[model samples]
Target: MLKKSELKDLVLEYGKKFLFPDFTNKLTWFVAGVGGAIILTPTPLKLIIYNWLVDSANLNSGTRFTLAELAPDAADYSVGVVLIIGALLHNIANRYLVYKEKKASSHDVSGQTNQIDKELFKKFLEDFPSNSDSIDMLRQQDFSNSFNIFRLANLEKFVEEWDTVEREFLNTDLERMRRELWEACYTFNYKLSMGAYDLNGGPIFSCIPDAYRGTDNWPAHVDEKIDELNGLSTTCFKLYEEFVRFGRKSIA
Candidate 1:
């Protein structure tokens, strides 16, 4: 099994190389060539070309192949697969760059980018707790906190809570702090979720009503999402403290 950081590195490396890669790049050519080959093979159109070759050679007509050599379904399926994969790759690269740019451009009170904030970035890299033990120390927990732990039903309410944080809590006029907090939330959000899509609150689910539309079990897994959001919220606060507690103060 691949280590998490190694896997992340692989994804970023390949995502950057193959998604809208320069024409001269080998990985770009490889993706195009492989995708083309996949679509062209197991297709009748290829058989027609082969037949032309056979006839041109005129060696013999003893080939046992029939006219239906190409499988139409296979061609259509390959096209769809290639298109979906290509679209996802392009999207992944775009999102990665957006997050990188957001974090990189953020500055300290001394006007240094967040990237050079070694201790803060180190904290950013640290793994958060799996259980709520740390959270328990920070605040009081009750039935309501665990009530949605694994939502058996009532997806609407679960998503409503999520949207409240994303829209109301995150939307702010404090330009620097707001942007930094958002980037922190999004970074944690992306790391926790396994899927390729951003899934980072506002970017993934604009509102409560729309959260469950594309998913199969927002109602069932609502609790896990709640857990994620809570964890991200905690991390966002820590990131803010890193700015305030340290001598950084605020953006220059």
Candidate 2:
């Protein structure tokens, strides 16, 4: 009964963890070898690079480009194209599995949180150990508490903990935007739970299954919080996408 957006976020973030962290490191040498030849001998190697680049017989048409189309000299053009593509692939790979601050990371920066949430959420749904007692617990409205805090704490110290990350390496603006929306949702959930006896993150207007919300006791201005909470969730996802896209472009 999970909403469409929840499913998309879970699947994408889950899939990201599987990406190889060393993808960029491995690809660098290939680009450097070809790129060095082009930079040092731009004109002479044009024909050779042009032949290798447009060798469609060996590779499929996955964003294929030619030296002529890329630059004045085919060699230089191919080098630019290769470097551009290699950079993008590396960016995705890095974000998907980059876990540098292992000792320093507290909560938000943990590389595997997204993947852990996915597994925990799925297991919660598919409970198997108990016969009746656990099944009854799953039916409770506050079942979300059985899982981890998928959202982050709003304190500045949480973000500061990640100071080990270079400013250039992390998208500070995009991460900040996401953090703002995440804090908005987290705060809203906290206030909502106080008025109605529910678990911390339970009864989120936008994310809760329609069946679950109908049973829970909501506040007078329920629509207002729903509107705000749903808006915050949407903004958070948009900011996350921006983080990934901007990282691809910014990685040198």
Candidate 3:
């Protein structure tokens, strides 16, 4: 004997697959068109008309159905088909109404689990240090040394921190934040690594002829780099702010 909960789950699962809204909507049309056509098919001539359609469509060329095979009489087959069609229509319409009503009432009936999830998500954001020390590990690097080496080390540390935090929160939104934060970190690191920057009162690397001397627009290029760095900084901080906002938002 199955439990009530298990039976309910099974039925819900079956409904989700077999009677999906779109599928049921299409099924309604299919049954209406095909069943109505068959019912209106003007009898004694009913099987002949159907078999003619089949033959015209080249459906199973060697075979045809008989009235006896379908039902004892033409009227009996029509009646039986009409009853089956009516029952199916009723079942589908009822299920569709139930589905819609449940959807409309979902937020009202969100219950304890939704509240618990909101709390858990908020708490997870509070505990996550992406906005704090983890991000700082990348930002506070000394570029005078092997900059890529520092970036790789800091990036690894940030990833380690992310890995630790990821185990705590299973939310898709949180996972998206992690991905965005990682992208921001990598973008900043790549920008800093590739470009020669004036740091510590000197150029970190000799400016390339292509970057400086090859074009008279080098000053504009330098301005573009500055703008890009500012944008990257803004993006990184925006993610941090988003995290803070999500944490602070009303759980109710």
> What is the model-wide C-alpha lDDT for candidate 3?
0.56
* Residue-level lDDT for 132 in candidate 2: 32
The C-alpha lDDT values of all candidates are 0.46, 0.45, 0.56
Tell me the alpha-carbon RMSD of every candidate.
Answer: 25.6, 23.5, 13.9
TM-score of 3: 0.35
lDDT of 1 by residue, 116-138 (tens): 34443333223222133332322
What TM-score against the true fold does each predicted structure earn?
0.22, 0.25, 0.35
The 10-residue segment of model 3 with minimum total lDDT is: 142-151
**Stretches of model 1 off by over 4 angstroms after superposition:** 1-43, 48-68, 71-75, 108-252
Write the residue-wise lDDT of candidate 2 on 77-120 in tens digits: 55656775765676665655455534456455544544443443
RMSD of 1: 25.6
| Model 3 stretches astray by more than 4 angstroms | 1-89, 97-120, 128-159, 164-174, 185-233, 246-252
Better of 1 and 3 by TM-score: 3
Winner on lDDT between 2 and 3 is: 3
lDDT of 1 at 66: 39
List the candidate numbers ranked by lDDT, top first: 3, 1, 2
Predicted candidate 2: what Cα RMSD to the true structure? 23.5
Clashing pairs in 1: 43-70, 44-70
Q: In model 2, what are the clashing residue pairs, if there are any?
A: none
- TM-score ranking from best candidate downward: 3, 2, 1
State, as a TM-score between 0 and 1, how close model 1 is to the true structure: 0.22
In model 2, where do residues sit more than 4 Å from their true spots?
A: 1-220
